[model samples]
Target chain A: MAKGPNVNWLPVKDDNRPVNLDLTKFHFPLPAITSILHRISGVLIFVGTAVLMWLLAESLSSEEGFQRVGEWLQSPIVKFIVWGILSGLLYHLIAGLRHLLMDAGIGETLEGGRRGAVLIIVFSVISILIAGVWVW
Target chain B: MVSRVSGATNLGRNGLHDWVLQRFSAIVLAIYTLGLLGWFAVNPDFSYGAWRGLFDATWMKIATLAAIIALCAHAWIGMWTIATDYLTSLALGKAATFVRLLFQAGCVILIFTYLVWGVQILWGL
Candidate 1:
């Protein structure tokens, strides 16, 4: 890692808190980054809801409408979008479950929270990739 | 430990509600998605009457209705929590809440209405 001159990475203690200067002063920590991603996933789900609903409506309308939707879905572009939506759904589900588990008094501690956040990302990526395989 | 009891209780209640529905809806959606894809694969030229007939099965109608309702509610609760977390302004959060409630209500009504209409179609009403 390249650091500019006069950069002092020190383990400074504040009050009784252990300050890992590399983590605190340099950049956002893993847990904070995952927390932000959780919010982003939620927003993605909100937007994807409209697309899924539109597809459902079209499919259920009539035979022609069904065919139309099917044909539209057959296109590679639409298929990719469908895959993207499903991936988003899978990721959101994993992240949401992580939050739920945290709420259940499971991972509120600093170390526990960090581990859980990493697990959320790992699970989300795996589930989303599985969904992508099924969709695409 | 003692002071956190109340907060823990609240968290458990809310998280359990969302978690249970999310799992329940995912199960239904998994079945529904497979069924839909299979139907399309088997019958390429699926017609209106055929479509009606497919949905005419009592269990199929009920299952699909259940899926739609669960999906809507699960999505609603999930999205609501997300909105509340992100939107700091009280007015914006309230407005978002109102809109989410309306959307959820509309989704339920639409699904139930469609189910009833399908029943009518099956019964020649």
Candidate 2:
């Protein structure tokens, strides 16, 4: 340890906080859970973006290519996958908007944060459902 | 030496710089997403001809290229944060740093590929 100059400080006490935490056992607050879901949706969007990119490319290749891409998307599994991606995207967008609001000092309080989280989840669910309808 | 000196990760270097980058990119990406959603709302049951025509426009092409670049920058910071948050020493023990580097490397490659492929798709003959 590096030596401190001038006045002497008191000795530090032993830290007893759990080092390896079991996340599932711990209860998280609404805002914390929303934050976690934001990350989760972000990661999901990351993978989905790649899939979307390919679809974009293939659809733009030719008229036949576009029709073929649409045909393959007729499968329920593919529709579900695309819906999942859209769901992730919708949730992520709403959550991200909340983050931007926080950045602008709009909803930085605890009460504000909780309300914001509820709003995020509610709006995201509504958007995701609408996306599901459109996709189907 | 610089990482040790500044206490910064080597991937994107500075925390504040990365924060600003992510914010700016986020705004661009958010607008692009909203724009696409609005287009879909307006163009229900849009045909291949309409879709191709939309992309064929110079302005839309420029907009897409800009969004692709923003996506790369935005995604890099997001993934880097995720890697550092979860793949740290507390979670992965001694090999966490190594694993993080590998993960970040993959993210960089994938993001860059997306940028190039997006350009190809946007402007390809």
**For model 2, how does the per-residue alpha-carbon lDDT over A64-86 read when each residue is reduced to its tens digit?**
98998899788899899999999
Clashes of each: 0, 0
Q: Any runs in candidate 1 off by more than 4 Å, and if so which?
A: A1-26, B1-57, B70-85, B89-125
- DockQ, candidate 1, vs. native dimer: 0.11
Worst 10 residues of 2 chain B by lDDT: B1-10
Q: Report the poorest 10 consecutive residues by lDDT, candidate 2 chain A.
A: A2-11
TM-score for each prediction? 0.53, 0.89
Place model 1 in a CAPRI quality band.
Answer: incorrect
Question: Could you list the chain B TM-scores for each candidate?
Answer: 0.60, 0.89
Give the true-structure RMSD of model 1.
9.7
- Tens-place lDDT per residue, model 1, A1-136, is 3432321222342344343434336677888888777666655755665676677566666677778887897789998988877776666666666766776788889999889888988887887776666655
True contacts kept of each: 0.16, 0.52
Compared with the true structure, model 2 gives a TM-score of 0.89
Pairs with backbone N, CA or C atoms under 3 Å apart (clashes), candidate 2:
none
Please tell me which predicted candidate would have the highest lDDT against the true structure: 2
